[model samples]
Target: MSYIRGYDPDTLREIVDLRECQERLDEIGPQRSLPALLERVWLLKVLGRLDEALVISEQSVRVARMAGTRKDLLRARILHATVLQARGALPAAMQELTTCAEEAEGAEWSGIAAFALQHRGKVSYDAGDYDEARTDFKRALFLRQDAGAADEQLESTLLAIDAADRRRSRTSVAS
Candidate 1:
């Protein structure tokens, strides 16, 4: 089973049937297959069952650690962070993203690193930490641009950053 990266669920569903994915995951056994669990978690997340997704993602990361695959662990961590962010657990989500970002830097996974940074920035923006948000967003934008991600995604992020900056400026002026 292949795990879906980023937030795209349509492409992910093409690779795995979401309805039977969980049973297939049980068949694969969590002890030996973190990727299977990760895919299940991603499907659950796309279905809007975030609490269930969180549980599965946590289990996936633990399994990845036991299996000694840093890549799998990193993927699970990023997915967990995404769920946390969705649930409004910004502090916990930022912490997870920070760890993922550091690991990605060490592993030379620029795309994943940028994704982590971008999410961290988004959480920061939600938490009203504009300075840190700006820094992270800029770093993410640079990395994503360098990695040749779709221009639309990069543009959306840039627009978010600009909106945040404007919000900060207005608050400062009102103060």
Candidate 2:
């Protein structure tokens, strides 16, 4: 189990200096385990290398599945869904995130559960399911709040909830 604490969603976005992170990743070449692969997958996604991200994402999921651990598999699936969303594969993204959310919740990985729910909320909103989107966003906000997670993540989820609510209202009014 490689150190995954430093590569949360915020940290992954902060790894915008890809050249530096890529170099660091190379230094850990021989030890490229599932955690490491997931890290690289996130960084590659941030760097807009969708194709490479997809490869690493799939590899990480495969490695995690072989590990036979719900925790590892849920995290991998979350990252995979993120990359799929980036690539505009919305249906696949939604599926992966939905499963990841459920598994993470059952595995008691609060952070992953909240993250998956947040993304799934976005996916639902994109799919025009405003009610479901609002439900997911509200649930994610509650989870993050209860978990004492970063306020930014909770705030983002809140904003999504508000947007979904407003959209639903507008749709109803239009009808």
C-alpha lDDT of candidate 1 relative to the true structure: 0.74
TM-score of each: 0.71, 0.74
Q: Pick the candidate with the highest TM-score.
A: 2
Can you write out model 1's per-residue Cα lDDT over 15-92, one digit (the tens) per residue?
Answer: 335556556546655543666777767667755678988998888888888884777778889888878887889889
**Poorest 10 consecutive residues by lDDT, candidate 2:** 4-13
What is the C-alpha RMSD, rounded to one decimal, of candidate 2? 5.2
Off by more than 4 A, model 1: 1-36
Error of 1 at 120 (Å): 0.5
TM-score of 1: 0.71
Candidate 2 structure lDDT = 0.78
Summed backbone clashes in each candidate are: 0, 0
Q: After superposition, how far is residue 38 of candidate 1 from its true place, in Å?
A: 3.3
